[model samples]
Target: MTKSLKTLLQTMPKPLFGMGAALGLLLFLMVGIAGGFWLFDRYNSPPLGILESLSEEVLDRDGNLLRAFTTDEDRWRLKADLDAVDPEFIDILLAYEDKRFFSHHGIDPLAVLRASWQLLSNREIISGASTISMQLARLIEPREKRTFTAKFWQMARAIQLEQRMSKREILSAYLTLAPYGGNLEGIRAASLAYFAKEPTDLSLEQAALLVALPQSPEARRPDLYPDRARRARDKVLERMAQSGTIAQSEVARASGHPLSAKRHDMPQLAAHTADRLRRQAPKDSVHQTTLNADLQQRMEAVVRDGADRLGTRLSAALVLADAKTGDILAEVGSPDYVSPARSGWIDMSRALRSPGSALKPFIYGLAFEEGLVRSQTIITDQPVNFSGYRPKNFDMDYQGDVSIHDALLLSLNVPAVALLDAVGPARLMERLRSGGVTTELPEGGDVGLAIGLGGLGITLKDLTQLYTTFANRGHSTILTDQPRSSAERQADASASPIPVLDPVASWHVSGILKDASPPRGAPNLPIAYKTGTSYGYRDAWSVGFDGRYVIGVWVGRADNSAVPGITGRTAAAPILFEAFSRSGLSLSPLPSKPYGAQEQTLAELPPTLRRFEISKSWLTNDSLPEPAPKIDYPPRGAQIEMTRTASGQVLPVLVKLQDGRPPFRWLVNGKVLQANGNRRKVAWQPSGAGLSTLTVIDSAGRADSVSIYLTLP
Candidate 1:
């Protein structure tokens, strides 16, 4: 074997043996490079956590920018959505920065060789071989100094980034983190700042300008150095033209385009609402709201314009929503979010305030539902005293013997209070709370007749939700601003909603309210609305609804200071009318009268509903039609011990009625308890050990009440 090996070696060609040796050395070099890369990757991973540090954004339902907040470092860095960005911009960016971005792994060797040659020929550094991935590494972990050591680590990190992320993700990171002068970063910030528009559809010249800015952001900022910025953009266009990526004609046209020397502010809509939701969930990067950007913009303008007419220290708010689904489309928290005198920082839409006559519709709705009154049923609007609680008309005058329809249309306080005195106040509050209303009541939260005349507290948001029920034919849904998936949003427009009234009674309410006069000289739109003014002119409210939309407006001083002489019809109703017109929607007619509901004239109704009369004190009548209700058991000022069963359940106290009409309803502490008809008795479980008021309302709209103390046994 030794002799044969010697013979073969002696006979082998020298060039072939040298060739084998070279191949072995090359293989050894390749393995060493692979081992080095593996170790580098294991020890120094790319700072991929920077991806999570993007600015929080709030967008409308269509993914349009509504508002955005800066990052922890106070930089305007937004994510670049490739689908929304123009594709031509991406091509121009690649042609100028890294032509071989798609083919190369992390670095382009040919470009590096060309740069080396140029540096040697010119005796100065000319260019560097930085790919998109390398640029992304530098952006996430920027180094102020330029050195070989820094370059080496940057190259290593680039390789790591490519291994961990896809090519598209790497390019997206570059687009998101690339600096564009001052605190502005990302393609989105650049476009919005310089162009005052989205990056979705960039012109040829604009695209080239954005492509050139990130290379030397501060030096080429158009707002700071217009000449340098233009030169840089022309350089990019020249390169694109030479590479056959763009036509020379296009290059010439783009070269002459002007650049703005000013920076514009980014979109800042829905300020109060966006701040609230962002604070609620800080970690969420994107919040999709139910707001309509176009409608929101229009409504904001309306509020700002109306602020001037409201005089000093006065502010306004409005909430517009879908009647059927209760999705809040446009909500203005206040006229100016930063105004000092108006206390504009306080979101008036959510702040509790007096609703005034805005709730009169609910009172009339309950009356019609209980068969106590018809549209044509006559009820006296004269001044009345209820157990020392006196309520008068808003104008301080009364109309004698008016039909129910006219009484509601006028929003007469006397008629409303009389109706509320018939129905329990507790019943109205509970009905409101069921539909997500936060009712704020005074005097221990157990209300009196004053509640029927803006005595209770409520927010514009809750008030709007209540009016949405009247428009939806008595069905009510909770108002929501958070956007849902398309499938989810359209799924249950007619699901089981909270029933504010039966269809028949709701139609009767709408039937009477549609005739309420609109703002003076305003277009007579197909809508049903009510206006209200609180006592002392503190809050003015107007809420109206077409077939498709419901809007509520409030004009007042946020500090709760009275702005005298500001009535709802003059201040708020005009705004409400304008909001619907600016909504970009044609007013839809109110719902047709539902089945089993027909307009009735006087003498066409039943005897009980013909005239709602419990007492005629103003008449010269010695004979009364019926006696007022009386609470016999648990007499007024009576204190009784509460009993409990063995199972830790409190026993209910029984209430007996006397000397009234049949079909009686009972109330305890202004809240209605379980009532029985014709039996004259009710069983009530006392809420706790305390003094409580118990009242009884007969079918004739006459009430008798008593106060009792239940002591714990």
Candidate 2:
């Protein structure tokens, strides 16, 4: 009752009346505007609207660029309107969402009034009586937030849409726009995802399941809530029967039917393959990958089953190709894959890892084909110390004086390194790159030995592709997974021979490599293979070819850490054998050629070395051939020594046969030794490490003949 309070009341009264009047006027204007828009939209909106856009593209396996797109995402959307929806689903959806749909127009005034009365009575808004048109409107114009304003817009849009399109069109839009579950935006995606078939292909029970999903897609995911979904499906059947949408027996059959939703457990094999393809075709728009469902499943089964038996933390990768065409047939990346329900990470295919000695055969074969060295050439197997790089033979022992054939057969590191040195790392790396190896080679000059030893990192895809050259007779071809046609067949048949390398040389190298891998118990089918072991046992690989298929198997831990004590022969060869065995190739032997097949000589031999000719009987015998004896010469001179091969013992006799007269002088520790009385004998003692030598002197004072000892340990 103070003066300020009285003044505030007076100020509030005058404006309050005016404000109320203005508010009433604004409400009236809004209602009038809304009403006019509704009437105009309902009466004037176009009927039988023309199609706006549509297109579809079909691609060949090579991504050879085919077709144009229609309506963005739907190249193959065969629309099934309301009349086409399996009658059971329509009944379930109508019974659950809107029992009065058929009885109402675009909006149900009674349901709206009922909803308002419930809200006024403080009851939860458990049900929405949106007619089919309203549902279609919400689908066409999705909103970020669900508010009263959104419902108002939906109602207005519904009336306009109903005038513009037929009931069938509205229902079709709803079916496609309806959200079912993850990756299932519409009835079609859900139908295929859950039932492994299309909407038209769904069974009665499946149709019920789809219709039940709109209530709660996640809570009733067929994969997650089989029981709940089944019960909801039964309710749908009952409602259909009660509503006379279907006969009593029909309802009984559907309600009592089992919910046979196809098992949606992530297909381990397919998912793994898709992951690999995704990596390979990241920007390819569409990935027409070479994945044979049957082959992939078989490979998965083998890897999973084999890993279990091996007792090691084992995993495997398998790639199959058409040997003639270089087309990949199948690929399995891993045993485990990513999924909403699963909890592990494994990307086995593209995971870069070391492919130990697996690269050896290709390298050695390429070297041989290039004529860097011959198979029979005597490559020293003795310990080699080149600069600071010293590689050891696998046995940790050197085999001295081995033929190149023996060295390669044993995969002796020194012989391979020697060949690499002869071929030059740069040239060899270029050959590998040309053969399809997309890997980083070690610095050619610095780490040439490392590359020779399989120290480079490479992905399984590239590794497999590189081996295709060997399988394809040293020709590179584009590999893919699309379907082949008769025209393509004729083109390939008429295509020119793949040009790159000498067929004879490549085949010879391949033959040698094939023999090198002597299968342990049962010989692996006539396979030309090379195995590799990287430092720290970080990787193991066995890439080879049977008569028809080229195989590459790489095994290692996923973390890029070393698998202690595992080598390529141990880890990957067995898997290769298994794959080859399953492929039905026989263990037949390949043709063999003589060592140094390209190099042989029939020319006359070089002249023999004999500095002095001598005879016996100087002391005892009466008759003997006289010796062209030795002569003394310069004060400081070199001496010749001869020794036998078996024992390091020196011989005392000098030979008469020589290119010219012997000018050799005999010297023992700086003193001139006299030729014996027989003239044939010269005093020579064992010296140096193994054997001694006798020197013969000629009239010119030049040493005529010297023979050095070659002792065998």
Number of the top lDDT candidate: 1
Per-residue lDDT of 173-218 in model 2, one digit per residue for the tens?
7676676755455675576567754465567667777887876777
Backbone clash tally (model 2): 26
Q: How close is candidate 1 to the true structure, as a TM-score?
A: 0.82
> Which portions of model 2 show Cα errors greater than 4 Å?
1-134, 139-173, 176-185, 188-201, 215-255, 260-288, 292-348, 351-354, 371-390, 397-409, 442-450, 478-500, 512-528, 547-549, 558-560, 579-713
lDDT for each residue of candidate 1 in 330-431, tens digit (9 for 90 to 100): 999888888896688888988889888888888888888888899999998764657656565665446899999999998888788888878878777766
Residues forming the 10-long window of minimal summed lDDT in candidate 1 = 616-625
State candidate 2's TM-score.
0.54
* Prediction RMSDs, each to the true structure: 13.9, 19.5
Q: Which stretches of candidate 1 lie over 4 Å from their true place?
A: 1-28, 485-498, 614-713
